[model samples]
Target: MLVRVLGSAAGGGFPQWNCNCPNCDGLRRGSIRATARTQSSIAVSANGVDWLLVNASPDVLTQLRAAPALQPARAIRDSGIAAVLLMDAQIDHVTGLLMLRERSTPLPLMATPEVLSDLSDGLPLTRVLSHYCGVAPLPLALDAPQAVPGLPGVTVLALPLPSKPPPYSPFRERPRRGDNIGLLLANPQTGRRLFYAPGLGEVSDAVLATMRGCDVVLVDGTFWTEDEMIRMGLSRKAAAEMGHLPQSGAGGMIAQLDRLPSGVRKVLIHINNTNPILRDDAPERAELTAHGIEVAFDGMEIAF
Candidate 1:
């Protein structure tokens, strides 16, 4: 199994435009030991030729340009994308689907029923393009093992995650239907398994059990603390409120890390620019390394 880190930043990306915060300012001035990353996305390949994109960020073109291996020998219209596995219906995660519209055939996209319904109803990319190929929405049953279309010997298991509180409805108990997911990929051919959760707010007992015996686990690392955005005055929201929990402080990533076995390799992805750990020289970065966790960066590749 070959796992490629396409982009590691959260929604707006590192050094996001329009605002000149210290991290952005330092990044622009080359004073801080920070790295520039795009929105969260990843690609996995069975033979390194036929690749499966985990999520299509808006920067898909740029990511493809960076990794020339992703382009098919044939024209962009004939490229071999086995399928696109959408984790959720967030805008940043699905905007890149537009690029597929330029292709000759309709793209096969796998997702939960709720996510599929949201896109089919609210954001219809099929209607946007004149040559817009339709999206073949495949249903993904939570925790049930299934095979990815066109990719034999590989299996994908959807791990349903808890959603954020209902914003519009005060009486709602669970979050909106289309909001959260995690993925577990198993390749019997390679005898490897990978667990990923980019938008997870909390790691459940079921998820922890599923993560066991995997070769690699790429978990969410959106915020370093619950009060991060509050301290920065960026928003009135807390990390937990946005369907992501912090990586540090009490009941956070570090605490959860202690539960995993030592053999399982771990990495944190979808990190925000406000995260001090972005800097290689930062103490936070050192701490993660000490605990055997890698902070993902764009262009990083891990092969098993």
Candidate 2:
């Protein structure tokens, strides 16, 4: 399996345009030991030729430009991207579909039924894309492993997660089982597994079982503490309220990750710009490193 960490920042990205928080200010001035990151997204390839994008962030155009492997080949308009799998209906995750409208052929998009319905009704990306390069919605079933279309050696399992719907959704009662999900990619050829969950509200028993014995696990690192956004004066909602589990505290992702097998390579992704771990010299970064956890950066590649 070949995995590429295309972007690692949360929705607004690091050094978000409107804010001048300490991390953003330091990044803008080059005063901090942190790298500029786009919104969270990743690309996976089983054969190194045809690739499947995990989530298409708003920065997909720039992200694609940075990854040479995803560029066109011999044909002038040929793209290496075979399909795109959406985890949720968030603007940051699906807006990039507009950028892909210029493709010569229609694109295959996979998402849970709830996410697809939300896009069909409220956001209408599915309706709009039908005019350009059409979007073929492939509905994903929770806990059911399905072959990723056009990618022969790869199989993806969508594990239901506890997360709220995007704020823009027309039906905003509360999140159900399939509103958000995590992906488990398995390569039967190499006996390697990779568990990726960039949006997590809680670590349920199903999530733990899915992550066990995986070669690599990339989980959410959105906030360092439950009250991070509150303390930073960024937002009034707690991390859990925003559908993210913090990395600190007793009932946090860090403690959950600690329980995983030691052989599993653990990584953190989808980090918020306000999180102190973005700073290279921050004590939080040191603590994560001490626990054998890697903080993902844009353009980082791992092959196993």
lDDT of each residue in 63-178, candidate 2, tens digit only: 99999898758596878899999999988899998999997778999999999998898899999999999988899988888998898887899988877788888767766778
The per-residue C-alpha lDDT of model 1 at residue 15 equals: 85
Q: Highest TM-score: give the candidate number.
A: 2
List the candidate 2 regions with Cα displacement exceeding 4 Å: none
**Positional deviation of residue 51's Cα in model 1 after best superposition, in angstroms:** 1.4
Candidate 1 lDDT for residue 243 = 85
The sequence of per-residue lDDT tens digits that candidate 1 reaches over residues 101-156 is 77666688888776765666567553564357777678878768988888766588
The TM-scores, one per candidate, come to 0.93, 0.98
Error of 1 at 33 (Å): 0.9
RMSD of 1: 2.5
Displacement of residue 266 (Cα, Å) in model 1 is: 0.8
